[model samples]
Target: MNAFEINGLSKVYENGNRALNDVSLTVPKGSFYALLGPNGAGKSTMINILADTVRPSSGTVSLLGHDLFNERNWCKRRMGVVPQEIAFDPFFTPREVLRFTSGLFGCKPDEAWLDELLDRLELTVHAGKKARQLSGGMRRRLLVAQALVHRPELVILDEPTAGVDVELRRKLWDFMRELNDAGTTILLTTHYLDEAEELCDHVAIIDHGALLTAQPMRALMRDIASSYLWLNYGQAVTLTDADHDALAGLEPRSSDEGVCLKLGRSENGDSTFHQTYQAAVARFGPPLDAGVRSEDLEDVFLRLTRRAGGDDAAAECKS
Candidate 1:
């Protein structure tokens, strides 16, 4: 069974702002999936809906084959959510917070598991410190530990590494990879496209509350057989009027190392890479070095979002 099945899901806030359109998506069981979007793409709204914090205007959702509305408690029992915001009781220590959260979920305190979590999250040294005393990164880690205290089958991470250091980020992802390898399904949302590209096999991009593209990472990549041809001359090449006229339609980006031209098919299904490259090479002389840089997730994201006219406003009135 799929981890989640959402059909025609939509959310409209009280301020007459529509946060989600008729969005339909399915996340396969045991797969690491990414829900990607711009600032106001309704990703947060969708996460809140799944966590039962926000009510959808209209939709049907199933978690692990159980109706989210009819079997709400059942679904919640099997799922864990790490929110973007860091919030917890100021007086409670890390250990106390985990224990309390576990109890609320009807789970007996598992000291061994708790210790393991603290160690894995690098919070063992600060286990006795109050929540308010911890740094931003530590608190973020605590949030993750709290979400997993009960060892739910499905884990949803919304910007879990927002404020963490690079070393800690790598360490956290290693721990998460271990958990995913042990059969825990992960759903991640982050502004870090590289993170999503590296970790997730399946991806879905939303823009302005509308579903833009949802497909396997490999399949999505296969549709774009394009690359940037980087030509590095020994010296910088100055662009003249003659050069500009010759390089028309190539969209050349100049750097200290000669010029880089975008080589791809046009919207009308015409490939100009070979034609453009030949003409530009004849004009600018042979380069000292040359290579091709393949398009990545960031390229795909910008292209799709730009096509949809997405803006920088926060979605659902939440950042």
Candidate 2:
């Protein structure tokens, strides 16, 4: 059964700006789903709607088989949300903050579980420190802990590792993996493509409030099995008509450095491409230094979203 299902979902601002358009997707139970898009791409809007923080202008949201709008309280009880903004009372310590959150959720406070959460998040030492006393990273960790305190079946993390270091980010990834392994579903939205590529089972890309594509991560990569080859030359080498014809199947484009060839699956097999590429380099002589690499999720993301249009693509690329 699907953990969450959004059908023809949409949202429009009071000023008449449409933030989300006819977006529909399903997330499987216990899966780590990553929602990728540019700033103002409606990622947060979708998340906020799911968290019951913002009501959708139209369409339906069903979570764990319960209609979100109809069974509002039940949906709220089953979902945990860690929003991008970390808000807290400056005077409240982590312990007090978590205790208050639990109270709001009507969950009995468990000191042992709270301690374990703090330890895992590496915030145990800061447990007694007020929110204002903690660093930015520490506060982010505290927000995650706050979301998990009630032990909801599904957790939504919006830019959870935005300003975190590599080590802590990896630690958090492992922790999230552990939670999903134990049957907790995770829905993540982040600008970090590497994290999404490494951790997500499913990925959905949206732009201009429209759903561009939603597929299993493996399937998406396989569907676009094209490697973007970057080549550098000590001296600029002008392309001959025959040279362009030789690699006709692959679309080759020139940049300031040298050239880039986008090799699709039908163009040449991996082994053949390597052999042909090396031969071309040898024939081109001394100046050319060629490197062939696979196209990662980031590359596919850029290509797909750029085709969708708007200035948001440029902003997302910069991010």
Candidate 3:
């Protein structure tokens, strides 16, 4: 089942700005998906379209089997969103906020259910605090809690952990994971690639209002196929002629941590970490120490977005 099905979604503001261009995506039900893009990559525009807060130029959007344009009310009722900015009134208490939000969907306050949400999000202690009075982290948690007041099937989080403490961020993601495990779909967008890598099951990269790639995290990362081999020669020594040639093009960096060589992942690369360490030994010979670090989500993100943006910029500049 798809929580969201969008095709050919495009939005062009009257100011001659194209917020989205031919964007298409499908978010699976009960999956934690990450929608990543650079600043002004049309993420906010896309989110607004999904939430029905903004209209599209040409496209179709469906939410949990409900046509967003035709069955708008049903679609809106089945999804929740935690926006990047704080959207509540400062004077309102957490309890009051949830009460008002749920009421929007014609849901009367159920004390037990409300309490459960507050507790699950660890907002019980600050339930009575005004939004202005709560700490940033507390306010962020309250934002998420209110989004769940109506028990929506899909939850969209835009930078949910921004400015949050590490411990609190971990707790928040843990709750999000639990919600996903229990069948709620989670769609996240954030500048933090590490966060997406840590929590998302699938990832979609969009740039210049266009979709770059959408695939399971592991599958997408497999394309990188690169790692770093850190080596220690025991004592400071110059590279032998053979050593220089063998390590050529590795962009090796020297530091106290030893010589770090950028390694291109071979098609026949080792299948396991232990095997990788052994392979490093075979390539670099014995050293006082050696380590391997693979390319992470950040690496992939930078490469794809930069390439896409560069190409788009050149074309736009030509005219």
Number of the top TM-score candidate = 2
Predicted candidate 2 versus true structure: per-residue lDDT over 1-319, tens digit per residue = 7889999999999999899999999999999999999888999999999988899888998999999988988888888999999888899999999988888788888889899889888888889988999999989999999999889999999999978888988999999999999999999999999989999999999999999999999999988535655567743447778778876755555556666565444354334556556645654643346666676788788778874443222222110
- Candidate 2 clashing pairs, residues 3+ apart or interchain: none
| Candidate 3 residue lDDT tens string, 98-174 | 88988997789888989988887788888888889988878888888888888899999988888788887888888
lDDT on C-alpha atoms for all candidate structures: 0.86, 0.83, 0.79
User: For model 3, where is the 10-residue window of minimal lDDT?
Assistant: 310-319
lDDT of 1 by residue, 69-139 (tens): 88888988899999999998999999999999999888999999999999999999999999999999999
lDDT, residue 171, model 1:
92
Each model's RMSD to truth, in Å? Answer: 5.9, 3.9, 6.5
Off by over 4 Å in 1: 234-257, 264-279, 307-319
Give the C-alpha lDDT of model 2: 0.83
lDDT of 1 at 1: 93
* Model 3 Cα shift for residue 304 (angstroms): 1.6
TM-score ranking from best to worst?
Answer: 2, 1, 3
The window of 10 residues in a row where model 1 has the poorest summed lDDT is: 310-319
